[model samples]
Target: MSVPLILTLLAGAATFIGAFLGVLGQKPSNRVLAFSLGFAAGIMLLISLMEMLPAALDTEGMSPVLGYGMFIIGLLGYFGLDRLLPHAHPQDLVQKRQQPLPGSIKRTAILLTLGISLHNFPEGIATFVTASSNLELGFGIALAVALHNIPEGLAVAGPVYAATGSKRTAIFLGRYLRHGGNFWRRAGVADFGQPGFANRYGGYHGSSRRYYGGALRR
Candidate 1:
């Protein structure tokens, strides 16, 4: 399949998976959910530094100063636009249940999903365009975009699940997936199956130790 087609398929699959997870009536543990969000954050941070920024710097004989300027401008543009709009938080209800009546939950879910979809549209275009221009650049963009998207899935799923308590319905509306045997197997069953898996084997403990040790040493 073509690159755009592949990306579309992958995005669709992700949405479907998110939906399924929402519908499965399975509540992912707080730790697991937290880890997933952390993973997504790490991935986005890495991609921003390693891929997107560098790509912007290297575009077609552009001076380092000009490239960097453009990069800053792009960042500001995003920031400005974000500021102009009403902030949509997918996990708003999930984290803080101070407002939002039960009757309004579904409406909120729909609005949240719509917001996410609109936000991702430009990202999809950017990924497609970059991949079309350079394979490595495309890979980097895809990785970064995928990382950014994961948390969004959690955002959509968490609130819907919280409000409705119906996994299938949530999945249908939000397009998230529940963890199943097949899903776990695909994601590495042994890793997930192990107790304290993220802490023991996924860098959490080591990173924490280093961070705390540095803080104490300082």
Candidate 2:
């Protein structure tokens, strides 16, 4: 098979494995989730800075100004999506209670999964494009993307399991974590965190979630 196809398949399979482990691994420890997410963040950060950006700069006849502009645009675009959506990362949720209200929990879980999936799409594209151009670069992108996706899988599974107390629900959430509309809905929850009494009513955990989420956001 062609390199692109091979890379795509490998990436997809890695994502599936991560999701499976997140969903079925019988009450995954918080530390495991945190470390997985952290590792993923490190991989992505390294690849983006050390590989993808430099490779983009190397594109023949591609002006440094244009490349920088595109890089800025990509950063902004990712930020917008993260801010405007209820994206999930391993550290974004905390055990506020033994059980959150059933409906609220379900909604949050769905939103989290959607956010993860939206985030994953661009990663998939990046892997595809980089691999199409250069095999080594593509491999690096795939590794980074795979690392990042693991925590996303955990993010999706954790809340779903919490809400429904059902492994199936958690797995299902993990499966659909990338769906767009779900992210939009979760974004509404995030907006509730802004000024006004709504922020109090909103589900704001302590800074741990923020730290982990910020790491993934990077």
Candidate 3:
């Protein structure tokens, strides 16, 4: 497999690490989780602003008007999706009253998995494109993505395990369903150009909205 594919796989696999932790009922301390999340968010922000956006704007024959326009569209698209989705934030589950109904927790896990899968699809696309263009940048992005995915895994698995008391089931759903259509979409990477304006800018804006939104909700 190509290095880019390998990076993508490794990043996606990070969800398993989180799933396992969640099944074991051991989460990273809040400080550790917060630091890791903040660091990853910072990396994504730097890459979006300093690397991806600039490179997209610098492409020969790329008009400045269209470049910024695409970035704005991406930003707007993220917000639109955020508002429209029926996602259950991980924090929402965590903050629920103690000993909630098992059926409710199961339903919440399913909904959360659906929401996380939607988010992961675009993230997969962005990771593959970034890695294909620049191996170094791709590695950085993969690491950032992997770091955040841990909590996502925990979010999905924790509730499922609580509802069913089955580690195998929880881990299976958390690992596989979390990726959803992303695995199939990986093949489409060949159809894309080398990390262009639309992909990078959109991914950047999406990542910003996801991270910032989570922060605001907390």
Each model's total of backbone clashes: 16, 3, 0
Candidate 1 C-alpha lDDT tens digits along 118-209 = 44544454444445445565565456455445555656666776776666666665542322212322233233322365435543222222
**What TM-score does candidate 1 get on C-alpha atoms?**
0.60
lDDT of 3: 0.66
Candidate 1, residue 186: the lDDT equals: 28
List the candidate 3 regions with Cα displacement exceeding 4 Å.
Answer: 88-100, 178-181, 184-218
Per-residue lDDT over 127-210 for candidate 3, one digit per residue giving the tens place of the 0 to 100 score? 676676678977887898899888788888877887877788898887675456356436445444234644665454333323
Among all candidates shown, the one with the greatest TM-score:
3
**Backbone clash tally for model 2?**
3
Write down the worst ten-residue block by lDDT for model 2.
Answer: 203-212
Deviation from native of the Cα of residue 96 in model 2, angstroms: 12
RMSD of 3: 5.5
TM, every model: 0.60, 0.70, 0.80
